[model samples]
Target chain A: MNRHLLAALGLGLIAGPALAADGIGAGLLKSQCIGCHAIAKPENTSLDRLWERKGPDLYYAGSKFNKPWLEKWLQNPVRIRPAGELYARHVKGGTKEDVVDESGMAPHPKLPKADAEAVAEALMALVAPAELVSKGAFKGEKVSMAMGGMFFGKLRGCGACHMAKPGFGGASGAELYTAGERLQGDYIYSYIKNPQQFDPRIWMPTLNLAEPDLQRLTGYILQLGATEAK
Target chain B: MMTNSRQLASTFSLAGLALASCFMLPANAAAADEQYAKAARNYDTYCAQCHGINRNGRGINSRDMSVQPRDHTDAKGMGDIPENEILKVIKEGGLAVNKSVLMPAWGNVMSDTEIREMAAYLRHVCNCGSGK
Candidate 1:
């Protein structure tokens, strides 16, 4: 079966207010979720580039997801984007090449149920950027993210890891060349901080970068789907 | 005429029985020996230090290991894990891409061919299969 389908089976534990009550649940979050998703109130977008490249950002999850939907998804994830994860290759392309087996998505086998509930609560409260994205509204050709996209897709070789544009690359991992259309920036950041926790063995490597570089990388990645490509 | 016929029939039956036993006995003995020899060598090199000679989860390093190794003789636990997964673990090491860090990375230390052989040994020695 597809890795996404296998992952969906175990995502049921990530529901609303996962972190509000603290105690054992908080401990579970520390060991399990913090490895990937951020626990500190969102601040520097520094560590956002080093994540698993699969799954969306949970940084401002409160704003982007409906409480009910978040709860439902935490308990049973669905295929929001049929393509695969967002950052599998850590590049503009989000390649489909290296996406490995998905049977690894078993619930934190050692985590307790009460803690799982508390983690859900904490996550449900996450809402970083409350602003709406103004993409297709037409900011016009005055500013061309195309140069950035080109640097991202070819010059920097982000396409080698992520999905390639049109026909240039293979699908060893996730699909990203068009992420501007799908993902939020905060979520992108979260994926970068810790990838293994999201899905133990993502195709990407752990580059161990500092915060500022992380933000600059995020800026580049989030521009994947810029409306006004030059 | 009756006595001659009886002796000939008796001789034929005895020879046929002896030939059949000779063919069957060696095949069975060789199969058992081959399986045992393979597992014995595997246990000595890869497992005996950690699992002990008895397969009782008490190797020399067992005391130092934080997460105690799984008892291979546990029919229930071994059944849950598939053979291929075990083979993968053995080849890649416990900490390789898919398993725990405590298990250590075996890819650099052991060949893929060796890993498969070790897995077969586990199946033969522990009788651990996917089925409970």
Candidate 2:
């Protein structure tokens, strides 16, 4: 009956639904993501464990993916790896029949906007190791397209597996053209330096590139997103 | 030293035998066709992105690559290359043949038989003669 009591009750009513939504989000991730993705800390870091995974490791999703890209991808799933994560399983023969089978690989399940946002928010909380996130890991350096392109295509052979431009390059790995917009710069640097740290069974071989080349390659990946924007 | 009539008769017999051997060509052709089909499928699944769906080396991914993929349709460029070279490239990648390293070695993933079939397919695309 008192004014103060009435105000307190109204605040509680507003906060209750928000709290409930967060709970529902956590529940949704547990039910949906656990089946395929590694939502929790991975128990094994062996190559065998990588082969056994059905989907990419998302334990570092918060530090790996750009928030907007993660949210958008969840709402409308698209093929990032042209050949899927495990290329052998996803890509069959090269015939028309084979192409059809390749198309039939398990597509990422889509989520409603609210569910996607909730899931994205939850995923973003999953951070990487402190060392991986150490200051100056990326240094925000820039590289000329020519230099970056050279490192990708000639020096490092990255184009063999990843698409440097839309529709160009290898089909078995993730298209790198949009990587700048899709991934965190630090994650890209870290992953390129050593993909085994994230996924040991990843088909991509380590180039063991020199430090300067690595920096150039990372800079070029960021440039790819900018080029796409134009 | 034989008479004209006798010589004509022997020539006719030889012609008949040659015509009979032509019948075996179809069976051999069919086997080649099957191998080619498999190779085509393999190319589509693995190489089509950079090599182009039509195998012209103008795949969608080629646009951004610093080194363009070899155009299989280029009869002149691929014609002189031996099947073994093509196979080497497929299995060991471009660097193995002193080419660009942009091509990844598929040895770890594809079997020897598949690599051979791919070589045959490349020859077929280039319209190159079987490197004897």
Candidate 3:
């Protein structure tokens, strides 16, 4: 009788808090988020469905986003994509076009501190396929901003679309200026290596970079996040 | 698939309208408007960051870049470079024309027809070439 009672107590001690924490986070996500955000990758990936998307894909949040950043970012959500998700939809021009349209279409709603943590927990649970992320392994090489900047801008022409530093480069793509802080280095390497793998028919071109280019670029992006970007 | 098809159709229609304008007929006023509107849209998407939305070389990024992007609004400057040169520069990038390395080759992203349209649009903005 004593052994049975002890086993029950132990099971409650372990599973109680763990289940409660994860359950609350999952519950919050289901109620408040699934309306706009996708917790699961869609089965149909046609261009129409891509256009219909409201928020960036969070299905791979577990692998793509860092937990701490997710928590902090949720508390005060900000626009990351410069031209909004679908550039064609949000952009316009006129006599006085004021054309930058840097403040992407609609700002993401922010969450309170505690809610942010819970949502982050739920978000971080959304991991990508192991095969993809497993292929990525960041060496964390320390590359100088000058060298990486040259590779990104002059050689590869990335500066034409993406910002290397805040407000310093072009604005069509997501500014990886804060890449290290905002993402896992492995995810950055994997995504840069093959963006279309993540989202087929997306605008990011295939650079067909080899080993060093991939490593160097990933290292540089990580370094970019470590820089003074907010 | 559906949206891509729609965009492709829209592009073809706009191209046909642009072709009409090349002959100076413009088909109808609405079609001509659509062509220019698309030109403006493309410009806003690709070139405006460094070249300035006003096409006056005061783009938001201009303050930081060492080499200033060309002002499409400058008639004399745009006229000096032949329209063919503009097309080549846009398609092959500045390095091809011994211009600033900052200019990336849009050939990877934009269609040849789109690049041709962009060159013509530059002429329109500068009030040179057929725009005169």
The candidate that achieves the highest lDDT relative to the unseen native structure: 3
Model with the higher lDDT, candidate 2 or 3: 3
Q: What does candidate 2's lDDT look like per residue over A77-194, in tens digits?
A: 9888876765545534343212213664788899999999888888887788876554357877878898788777767678766878776666667888888889887888888877
Ranking of candidates on TM-score, top first: 3, 2, 1
Clash pairs (backbone) in predicted model 3: A47-B1
> Against the true structure, whose TM-score is highest?
3
Q: For all the predictions, what are the DockQ values?
A: 0.01, 0.10, 0.12
Candidate with the greatest DockQ versus the true structure: 3
lDDT of 3 by residue, B1-132 (tens): 999999999999999988877777645655656868766766765677567667887654455555778888999888899767788888777878989877766666567888888888888788877532
Docking class of 1: incorrect
| Pairs clashing within candidate 2 | A94-B41, A94-B42, A95-B41, A167-B60, A167-B61, A168-B60, A168-B61, A168-B62, A169-B61
Q: Which regions of candidate 1 are displaced past 4 Å?
A: A1-147, A154-156, A164-170, A197-200, A208-213, A228-230, B1-132
Model 2, position B59: C-alpha lDDT score? 61
By summed lDDT, the worst window of 10 consecutive residues in model 2 chain B runs over B57-66
Lowest lDDT 10-residue stretch of candidate 3 chain A: A91-100
TM-score of chain A of 1: 0.37
